[model samples]
Target: MGKATGFLEYERQGGVLVQEKQRIKNYNEFHEYLSEEEQQIQASRCMNCGVPFCQFGMEIMGMASGCPLHNLIPEWNDLIYKGNWELAYNRLKKTNSFPEFTSRVCPALCEAACTCGLNGDSVSVRENEHAIIEKAYKEGFAKVNIPNIKTGKKIAIIGSGPAGLAAADQLNQRGHSVTVFERDDRPGGLLMYGIPNMKLEKDIIYRKIDIMKEEGVEFKLSQNIGKDKKASEILKEFDSVILACGAKNPRDIKAAGRDAKGIYFAVDFLTSSTKALLKVRQKDKKTDNLAKADGFIDSKGKKVIVIGGGDTGNDCVATCIRHGAKSVTQLEMMPKAPEKRAQDNPWPQWPKVCKTDYGQEEAKAVFGSDPRVYQTTVKEFIKNEKGELKAVKCVNLEFSKDEKTGKNLMKEVAGSEKILDCDLLLIAAGFLGSEEYVAKAFGVELDEKTNVSTQKGRYATNVKKVFTAGDMHRGQSLVVWAILEGRECARQVDEYLMGYTNLSPQ
Candidate 1:
């Protein structure tokens, strides 16, 4: 759809990244976008291949190969390459509801599966998407679109994360009155608090939320559906209830002296950090001066140890560095991945290679080395006389394959215990599943994995007019997957309410 030989003629160039040395000084979006002309050149590199796997949206070897939302990559790339910004945004929005969020935070599965990436650099699809969405907002193409017809049906979405927001957007557009309930003060659940502000600025979330409010979608923030408002009341009021609260019940570290005062869950830490920043910004209209905010977990001049080596751990490392930490260390139970893709992990399959995310990059730039310590786990949390964290006892781990099961098993290595000074410990061990209270409150059954259960390949619950989607239904996953499930769930709900739906069949 782009230039026939553009892939051969042009090289891949991405958005300008602010130097870590300077960007780490504050919490802000650090990537500077390219000009429209430059983005058009990048878009022109789209091969328009016979099999455009960039939008395949399927599983390969149990790993996601492309955009789960099935974005029309080629058509939008062609439109952008022709300098048709409005049409590019139109095509882009046909599939994705929140391009701004995904363009910034998504791992870019599209590029991973691009045909050009098989031989060389892939098209900068994510950057192109970012450019298109930002331009749409600038040119007023993304203004509020209030529904003209009212179907008189009401929907209650019991969360404000990507999934809940997607469903609310879709259902509201379909002429159903939608009210989104969020326990947090802000509307974007994980996106608003769980994710660090530097990765996704709060203003960006607010921008879209304001548009939704103008478009007739109601947001009841600081309202916990089960506690603040009863489930029975919501059921009686709304025609359909969608539980998209997400899997946020954190898996805690079960180590000796686990009750240390300075240890906290990763989500709590991130939420507090973002809240502190926002409080400071709101008071002074500035991003800095966070020291004045209350309830902030101060890591200044403290030795910090983070448990788990995923994105949350990396975010903790960067947040600690920004807090003026004395030193930082990250513990991971699993062994480090290979620097490059393994033979078993080929192209079009999600690569199992190591990635240095933005947070890790900032940590290295400040600390002179990567903070991750693979094949290691904390054995005990050493506490002081006041029951505050003072140090951590760690042990090395080793893995061996079992001949019968053909599965790898982990064991603690003998005589490898070490004690490191740690004033603060953050557990980023991930989530178990959706919190049981919400499910129990609504009489929703849970699967073995603790996710809200449903019939195979369906969003309907045992209760009539009650559906579920996103992490609550499928366990923890990416934002793109959440949006896809939300859209699908909305279609199901529309059909149930009106006995038919015109929404996309995604």
Candidate 2:
């Protein structure tokens, strides 16, 4: 440990953000990087316990408790505290290929299981992580990693999200020619579109992609493997294929008037808004009619109703508020978690506490209150004469134990139905599984949950010379988990190609 009494002396200093009033004006990253001194103090707060639960990476109470990537949290934090920038970055990259992505997007599962959090606030593990990677970039240590030799082998990776990108980075470093195919015009997959610009700027992703390209990874954009290009052709061309297409089959809200216009999936809405936002920026166009453009949905001067109270729903709330929506509301099926961790939620398990996120914070600031309506759901959709969504029929829910199964069930209150004005309805209810075409095209089997099937604890699919990873195999998960899956999958692919392999394991 850098300082024995560091945890006692220093309070957690989280990353600061731009004021809501200022940040709401534009779609750009708002989190202000902490200074070197402050970051050091945060890093020094790590207890560096005998067993660092922060990096334990185990399932506790059916939820992720530690860093899924098994990040070397204490090592890097100590390095940061001691000002060993290069060593800290090296240790970080050894376990994670994309700290930049995880630093911004990962829920910081490490922080939740921190030893410090057992009694006091968690050490600023996530913010310190963000600091290390950003500082590495500033110090020019984030350079291209070119292979010293060529293996004369080729790998084709489907989907250019975090998983595919990590696999490509690893395999390319192992002297294999790696090629990533992306269905969208941009290559970062969900990282480029599904997530908003304010949280993770697109340019950061582009810069990383550019570095990968320079390091000999070939990116094929707008190339849908199952449709635009034949899977048979890809199989014939490469020695191996890794599918990381992600779980994109969005769950629908099957309520009354569900087919009404102005109804969109959360990903679709986010993707369209981002695409339009960038297009306007690139064209240097000056207009407030962003949503008025064809195929774009704007929330300006409208009452926006978002279903499902997860990160996606919160993102929708923030986006709508930025769009100048007259008012915004979010509906969650489950009751709100307590302000503090419940007794059942012991240490090392994900707290499941009611913590306000950036989006909710912004919504609270702008709308004068939190927009989340807990234990609520949309019962039906109210449509106008033109078949456009105008309002949502909502109802309150109560959790009760089933008499037969002893399981908790959501029982709708008999007289709690109410109608709320809604100009646009975005389904943020999460995803079911991966889309069907690619799996069917490649003849890969899917599990009961609709995810690509692989042997228990393995990344290789039943199909010969094919593999699956990330959300495609594990269902929807954190960015850190995706990176872990990709890295492990690459190792498996490498071992299959050569009789053995030399890849790092977390």
Candidate 3:
């Protein structure tokens, strides 16, 4: 720790953001970085507990309690507090390949499990991390680390998302030749498309990819293994293949008129929006087929209905507001959570409660009302004469314990059907699993939930030289988990390829 009495001297100071009214007018990041002095003070707040549960990465009640990548939180926080930013950045890079992405989007499990949080506020670990890495980049401290010797082993990483990228980073550091294949036009998979540009700027991803390229990692874009190129062919050329394809199979709504026009998956909408933004940025005059599809589903002058209440749903609301939507509403099947932690939830656990995210704040600023509706679900779609969705029929629900199963079950309230006028509908109902095409082609077994089946510790599949990581192996999760799985999976692949490995998790 920087100062013995730092926690007592300084209270927690979170990162500041632009006002909602000003931020909603454009699709750009509005979060302001804390000054260097302020960041140092925040770093000083780390009490550096004896056990340091913030870096333990244990599973409490099936949910991750700390940094899954096992970041050296105390060491880095102490480093930052002492004005040793370069050392802190190096410590962060030891485990995570992409701190910029996680710093921006991750939910910050470390703060939730902080020992200081038991009595007072937790340290601003995430913000301190963001400051350290960003400063390293600006001061030319972050550079490509090229291995001195080559192992003569070749590895193919399928999907260029966080998991694949982390695996490639580790394996390449071990002197293994690594090539990543992505079906999309660019690398970074979901980071490039699924997430909105406002949350994570595409240039940040490209900058990291450029450094990785300089480090001798090859990225093949628009190459679909098992489709454009055969999976068997890749297996023959490379000594080992790792499938890092993320969970892309969206969980769809199957109500009446589900196939009607104007209704789309949240991923599809977000992807289109990002593509449009990219095209505009590059000044591409040639219109693509998607660009020709009534011009990218702009919410301008339209009433929007989002069919979920998770982060993705909230993102949809924010995007719609930016596009100048007339109105916006988000539906949640589960009842609203309590405003504060419940009695069952104790110290050192992730608190489950209701909180307004950035998107809801934007919606409230523009429309003068909160956009979420709790304990509600869409039952059917009302279509116009042209077979386009015009509105959604929905109903309220009540939750009660079932006598037989002793589980909470939802019961729709009788005579509670209602219709809301809507011109655009976005289904943000989450993902099922990784896409089936590559898994099926490789003959990989899948769990009941459609995730690739593999033992937790042993990430290898039934196939001898095949491995899996990220959402492909563990299903939808945080970027931090993806990075951890990727790093561990790369160590496994290294040992399998050479019969020994020196890649360190420390």
| Candidate RMSDs in order | 0.9, 1.5, 2.3
lDDT score, residue 204, model 1? 98
For residues 351-458, what per-residue lDDT tens digits would candidate 3 score against the true structure?
Answer: 787979999998888889999999999999999999998999999999999999989999999999999999899999999998899999898999998899998687
Superposed model 3: Cα runs more than 4 Å off: 284-294
Superposition error at 192 for model 1 (Å): 0.1
Which candidate do you rate higher for TM-score, 1 or 3? 1
Error of 3 at 261 (Å): 0.8
Q: Give the alpha carbon lDDT tens digit for every residue of 10-51 in model 2.
A: 988876789998889888888887899989998999889999
lDDT of 3 at 273: 82
Number of the candidate with higher lDDT, 2 or 3: 2
Best by TM-score: 1
Candidate 1: 10-residue stretch with minimal lDDT:
283-292
Question: Highest lDDT: which candidate?
Answer: 1
User: What clash count goes with each model?
Assistant: 0, 0, 0
Query: Using Cα atoms with residue i matched to residue i, what is each candidate's TM-score against the true structure?
Result: 0.99, 0.97, 0.97
